[model samples]
Target: MESSSSSYLNLFVQETAFYNRIVLGTLLPDIAWNPLPHFFQTWLRNYIGGTLLYFLSASLWCLYIYQIKRSVYVPKDSIPSNKAMLTQIHFAVKGMPWYTLLPTVTEYVIENGFTKCYSTINDVGWIPYFVYSAIYLVLVEFGIYWMHRLLHDIKPLYKHLHAFHHMYNKQNTLSPFAGLAFHPVDGVLGATPHAMALFVVPMHFRTHIALFFVEAIWTTNIHDCIHGKIWPVMGAGYHSVHHTTYRHNYGHYTVWMDWMFGTLRHPIDDDESKKEF
Candidate 1:
């Protein structure tokens, strides 16, 4: 009787462990192979840090736009009426709803089968998270830069897809999401390459969170008037020129590539000023 009781207890423990593993593997596959530390890291960076930064930056920009519209001077002859412009800006920003549906869909696709192509590198461990992120960032930036330049090169696509963003030529906080109000094709083409990077590289949850925050911050800065005033050293005026002329400043994040390839367009600070390519 004693021997039988011990055997039953051992079987029960094994079954419980197996059940736990199955549950984790299904629900939280990112950390299934290496839980505990990886899970904590993901939670800390993604849920806590990333969420806080998104809200905080967005709130600050909203407030800044509100204040600027109330206080700034606008020439009646050259600029749209302040109230009219503000209404348009509000519409543009409100169009891009902040939701997790897209990311959730992407994550599900990755976990189920799409990630298998790159899953072989899963055993490469965690440190490559940062390396892969850095490489992906560069590749995405290059892709965006060239794609934007091409949009300008092709007039019909620019008129139909990119013109909505330039509707408000003057910079404002709302301009970042202005592009989001574009045709679905615009969104798909512009966003797919960045999203597809996950399948090309081994990424941890924390890397995804970091990329999200980096994109949000850079997009906001590129569209906002703040960069025009703050980052003057890094050719901050480039994006402003893009808005004003609709011809240049195609690079998304880093200016290094733009500078290297002679795509950098800086405005002339003088009357006889020629733009440095």
Candidate 2:
């Protein structure tokens, strides 16, 4: 019989290997230390290949979301607040390490045998991958909503942990990076959902990887303040209302939770006309 310690040890090894690929592989992939001037070559190579690979994927994903928000919801003339965008970029650049450490790359390696293969993948077909993806998204929303609401509900936690994020609440004070312009603790709490799911869920690696980028783009969508006709499902418009009101609309990716809790405030009721500009 497998002992508990042995089981834990195995899990730890897999997780360690996954994280090592994320932290070390990206920072110093396939290279040894070099001396003096030649070291610049290593740095440059890592910068382009390791660093850019992570943020570039996130940036490209964000760009696609920005286009949809710009064309379908926001007016061509609308401009975001400079303070909001600059702070967002500052934090985004600072958080470049985290962008690469998402489950997508690690899971991709596991499922595709590029790194490690789990027996769970062999047990299922493609349909379960889609199902697992949907479940992961829902779990993330559920986890984030509670943590997010608690941040707003608790005075001390809000002031010290979440208030920095609320600074960008005003209209036009947002950009793609705004999604990540959060205090470190807030970032951890906000992301706890995905991390929790990655361990427990029997998800396909490809679906696991794809959802991270999708959710990253979805974060930008909420900050956009543009209420598409389908904003109830898509959630960007309602999240805008949450920023302004500061007491309602706490769902992560859907209005289901907010509506159930009576915290849901429709964008049209919040005055949709002035939100675009």
Candidate 3:
């Protein structure tokens, strides 16, 4: 058992080094970070990479949804003001470094064999890989559901920690930038499920990393207020309502949680007409 654990650590070290050398080194060669300890490299890479991904993805999506497709998605007089967007961007940018720390620490934990994170899909076979991935998602969804709900349900948690996120309480103030416009702790708590699932379920290392990055994209999508009309998905439409009502649609990724918890509010049921410009 000790030998097996050591092997996993070795693989983690090698993979992390290779990633830092190839990916991070190319982008941040001046930093001379490749030779640093694996933990530091992970921290640097996640911070840099996460910040870039957040800005780049949010910018492009904002362009498409707020500009290119504005007439198609954004309702007349419902477009967020420039000042509102800038505020969201400010909060998001300010929170990114602290938010990235969660994943960096999560990687460190997984590297030290503190979590059930496998190095590769082959270790668990194809069937189990998919099965485990589903399990991880479910665990994350459930955890985030309760975490988000409790953030509102508990007065102190909501007042001190989560209230910062509720500043954009309307469609006209919400935008792609509002996605990560959370207090550092608020944003981290919302995503804490991803890391927490590591200790509870077997997760593919690559899948875990990919999902974390994918979250950057997903959050932006759900904040755009453009309903994708995809059933079961907790899309922007539902999320827009959540902003206004403050008491509904606390689920992430899907509506199953809200539905089960009796907090689900369908976008169609919302009195706000989905009128496009």
Candidate 4:
């Protein structure tokens, strides 16, 4: 058992020094010459990259979903007001710095060899790599469901941290921008599951990073209020119900959690909900 555990531990640490050199040394060749500490440099890189990814992804999705296919997916009368969208944007912009900290700290942790992240699939073999990936996602899904539920169930936590997000509880009050328009702490807490999964699961380093960014896009998709009606998948339809009712469909990527917890509410229950903004 000790030898087996040591072998896995070595795999986690094997690429740490190499990745550290690549990230701190050559990843940002320009920053390599900068005098700021490595931590700050990593934070700065993640901040800029995250910001661009959020804006580009959100804006394009908004254009495609809210404009290009607006007629097919959204009702003219159900459009969110400019004030509502602006408010969402304002909150998102303000909270971005705090949100960036998760990735910054994650990278720092991975660089230091604290998590069960292997550098390549070959390190664990293809079969184990695939199995681990599935397990990692399941762990993340479970964590996010409970974390999100707690944000609502805990009175003090909700009143102080999550109330800001619930402000846009109506369809017309929601937009792609509202996806990340969370209180700084609320935003970080919501995504804490991804970081938590790292410590518990053996995940591919690049896959984990990609999944984190995929979440930014996923949030926007769900907030757009266009239910694709894909069963089991928690599309915007189910998310729309969550916004209006606030107690059902709290699952992140799938309905399995909500279904298992007896909190799942189908969007079809309300015909009017089909036109949610």
Which structure among the candidates has the greatest TM-score?
3
Q: What is the total number of backbone clashes in candidate 1?
A: 0
Q: Write the per-residue lDDT of candidate 2 for residues 1-277, one digit (tens) a residue.
A: 4575456335534553454455445666445422323223323333334344435554664456456445765555554655657777777566544443444334433433333223445457667766766776777778888889999999999999788888877666755557766776676667667657665566654455446556666776667665665644746677777888988889977777776676777777645423421
RMSD to the true structure for each prediction, in A, is 10.9, 7.5, 3.5, 4.6
Task: Put the candidates in TM-score order, highest first.
Answer: 3, 4, 2, 1
Candidates by lDDT, descending order: 3, 4, 2, 1
Q: What's each prediction's TM-score?
A: 0.59, 0.67, 0.94, 0.86
Global lDDT of each model? 0.51, 0.61, 0.86, 0.82
How high is the lDDT of residue 213 in model 2? 54
The C-alpha stretches of model 4 lying farther than 4 A from their native spots are 1-33, 270-277
Candidate 4: what lDDT? 0.82
State the weakest 10-residue window (summed lDDT) of model 2.
33-42
lDDT of 1: 0.51
Off by over 4 Å in 3: 270-277
* Candidate 4 residue-wise lDDT, 209-269, digit = tens: 7798799889888998888887779998898889989898899999888878878888886
Better of 2 and 4 by TM-score: 4
Model 2 quality (TM-score) = 0.67
